[model samples]
Target chain A: MAETVLSSGEKIFILHGIDADFRNDGRRRCEYRSMEIETKLMPQTHGSARLHIGNTDILVGIKVELDIPHADKPNEGKLEFFVDCSATATPAFEGKGGDDLATEISNVLIAAYQTRNAFDLKTLCILPHKKCWKIYVDVLILQCGGNLFDAVGIAVKAALNSTEIPKITAATLDGGEPDIELSDDCIQLDTSNYPIIITLCKIGDNYIVDPTLEEEVCSTSSIVMSVLPNGKISSVVKLGCGSIQFNTFTKMLQMGEIIGLKLNKTLMDVLKEENQFGRQRRIFGFLK
Target chain B: MPVDQRRINGPEVSVPYHIYSDFNKKSDKVKHDFSKRSDKRIDSEIRKIFLKTGIVSQAKGSAYIEMGNTKVVCSVFDPRELSNKNGYCMQGEIYCEFKFAPFSCQKRKIHQQNAEEKQYSLILQRALEPAVCLHEFPNFQVDVYVMVLDNAGSSLAAAIMAASTALANAGVPMFGLVTASTIGIYGNHYLMDPTDTEEAICNTQPDNEDDFNHGIITLASLPQHNQISEVFLIGSIDTNTIKQATEILTAANKDICPVLQQCLVKTIMKLHNEKK
Candidate 1:
């Protein structure tokens, strides 16, 4: 008896529709809802972005704080992802209800951004072993439209691209305590080569990308594919119940590859264009 | 785009950005120095308060308030079911959550509720409990979520005003409207309705962090009965300042009583018109 109580008849009807290769909303297996993206809404943070895909509103903010690099990876900076499903969105996420979902999403993000191929971490290191910047990419889920994986990934990447880490004017070693001066104007972090996630929902016969909530309920299985900008799979893991056949899984990988490449190109173009027209970024927050 | 309120600044050599690396001391001073304005008023002077009702199209009843820099949006959720396993429905429950958007301050915060937010939420719960009619809606809970979009200062007091407004908005029966405000004590001067930059901080760093503890007072009142619904204190302050702030805040909040009542009156009138 989950909170979402879809009738048995409705569930059956959804399954039947999936068999015929069409969803209830008349969307093809590979269609997404309308998406709107806005960046730098939070003037207090280093970088911030909010994305609304249907009713699902996701906000991602990145803060660059000085810290010592990892003992194992001294030359590389650090990136940590934390997701909070606030109760303002839904009562279901009250108290500790959203912890499991937060952990799942954060774990996936950590795995996806593990390698330099997906995201460059070395540039974050200010000095060899002394100090580096740890970018905390915190995601707040204001609404729970389905296909959260894709929405979060897209928002995180956009926020990262919009992140302006203050340029270090000078770093001097004086009497064991290092003194670092930051530039007046904050400089945008170079994340033009970040990764994007594509979720493939295994409907009855066909695989759907970016499935809606109603569609998510009908699907038997789904796989979240984190596709990097270099046209390689960063991580591929299955989610939800049921299983996909080997042949269909391979086909999804292929479809994901094609979609992934196109997605990367368009995303970069949007980000670059948004940055180019920067002065006009008048933040219209939720009030509007 | 509400283009009128925005300030688009060009590049500058010295922005006077205040960095707060240490705790127990008030943060740095930025552009919005209320004390040095043309009025020559001290920082503690509260702005003229106003309350409007029946503004929200969707809510049953509603009220809007402005207190200098602290702009809060509050909506009363429900006199609905108590979903949690643990519940004593004899008296209604009051749930208060205080949130400050990352962009609400000069420094952009990561999109997470830090420890301070939790403390604020608890403070809200304490301040609001007295005003809410907990026994009226038993076997139910009312939720108040205060969203601070643009935090200029004294958000907690604003939150109290918001909760009362939201309760009226939801058509929930209540004892009376409540108004709240904060008073700041700096040096020999006292300030009312301190902004985010002035939140419980010393103007200068102390030789010992524990030495300088400026006093802060938060007060919420029900005007008709002269009932003090909520009161909270933070930092350090002398007895005279506390007594003075209470008097000033009570006087100010008493004036706001009609604004909240007007909302309820409008809501009642609207319902009556609908019935007719």
Candidate 2:
């Protein structure tokens, strides 16, 4: 991960701040930074969204393509997660330097969405054992403030929500071959059950949500948990060099569930409010 | 027939895709018109540029430049201790990395840097080395990274301009600033700062073997030094046409040099005021 070196004293100050239930930005341990989201910004893609959480800016674009379903799972579609860490975020991510981190984040996303109830791939199936909608969720990290996984997950959800898949109007068998026709109407995806990840960084004895670069440097370990809207934990992954006891790990998981639920609720509310604006929603990409 | 397990599989859709057909129709309609480009700019006019410095707070210096829809961000890191040591070295090394975002182009780019990106990195390094005073930072290395947010056209030229401005913003000693611009030659007409579509149309080779008068020329130069640092040409064109294109690119670079100077001045003034 791209990070800054924090001195011991600075680390102690952050630990003390967390112990008091207050962070450097004057927020509670569970509080999150203000986020700005805009959807359908990239006209080229079927669905696109730009998200800013503090300084970690992410752009997610979803492209839907037609492909043959797997033989084992002929009725299900496919979801692919691709993460590109832009060199502008840090010099450490230049060229192939960021590939390892990108693969790690993408793997976590794939695992999060792999659950049966997390995302229904059957809805994307156009025809059994034939054509299906393959959704490609490409995430671009323009800047890294901290807490990248959570930011990427939220942006992916927003993009997937805004995605409009072309409706198949007609399918027929002509001369022993299947033929498909696409309609002008595009159907908006139902992303209500999409999973959102929340990363809790352990600083000293307590865990904090949304660790900044300095706080991340001071953290010994972090737990990333993906929570669905129905309060189901889809996946869990631990990062950093620090180890946690089994009891502490269980507590961390519980804390993750609580914070993840809150984050999802707020995210849904924000998306709902933005949708109410309809076509009048202003798009401010990186210009802002 | 056996399935190819090595390649990622997808749902098989019918032929004659609607999206591709729509794009083809749109382009076919524009192929005949030669009066002006699609964006309503004349043959010689360049797109409007929006340039800013110090956009990345973490980097020592950074710049973001947008030419119409083309967006490029370049960041310069502070001088760091060189990892490779081979005897005594007098001049510092400069490393350049160029990348295009997955969704920057019409087609989605992969996470890894492709062959074209690596080639552009080499070109950028050559373009920037002429301007930087490398000997000042002995036993250290400075890294410049350029990311293309949106690739409309003239991305290399835009990267060159952004990287040079970012170096100046970082307070790196340099002989002069480098400005760059690209021109597309189609038949007898020269298109300045062509967009992606225009570039494709210009670069497309005709089926007939007799007619081959299309190419793209990118020129990076120091206007004060009156010397060209790098020239990247693709496709095929006559020598005379190449000369004409170079002149046009040089003039465009001259036009853009003042804008770059103004941007650097604004960044320096901001830094100076912050110091107070």
DockQ of each: 0.01, 0.01
Which 10 residues in a row give candidate 2 chain A its minimum summed lDDT?
A240-249
The true-versus-predicted C-alpha distance at residue A95 of model 1, in Å, is: 1.7
Query: What residue pairs clash in candidate 2, if any at all?
Result: A67-B10, A67-B11, A67-B12, A68-B10, A68-B11, A68-B12
> For model 1, how does the per-residue alpha-carbon lDDT over B1-276 read when each residue is reduced to its tens digit?
001223434332222244323322323342235447433556646765555555666654455667765677776665678876754657777777778877787655434555446546655665566566777888787777777777877777887887787776777776667777777655455677775556534232222332232545677776765756545554333334445656777887787677677766776788799999
Question: On residues A46-77, what C-alpha lDDT tens digit does candidate 2 reach at each position?
Answer: 99988898889999999999988876457889
Please state the error at residue A57 of candidate 1 in Å: 0.7
Worst 10 residues of 2 chain B by lDDT: B1-10
**Candidate 2 residue spans exceeding 4 A from truth:** B1-276
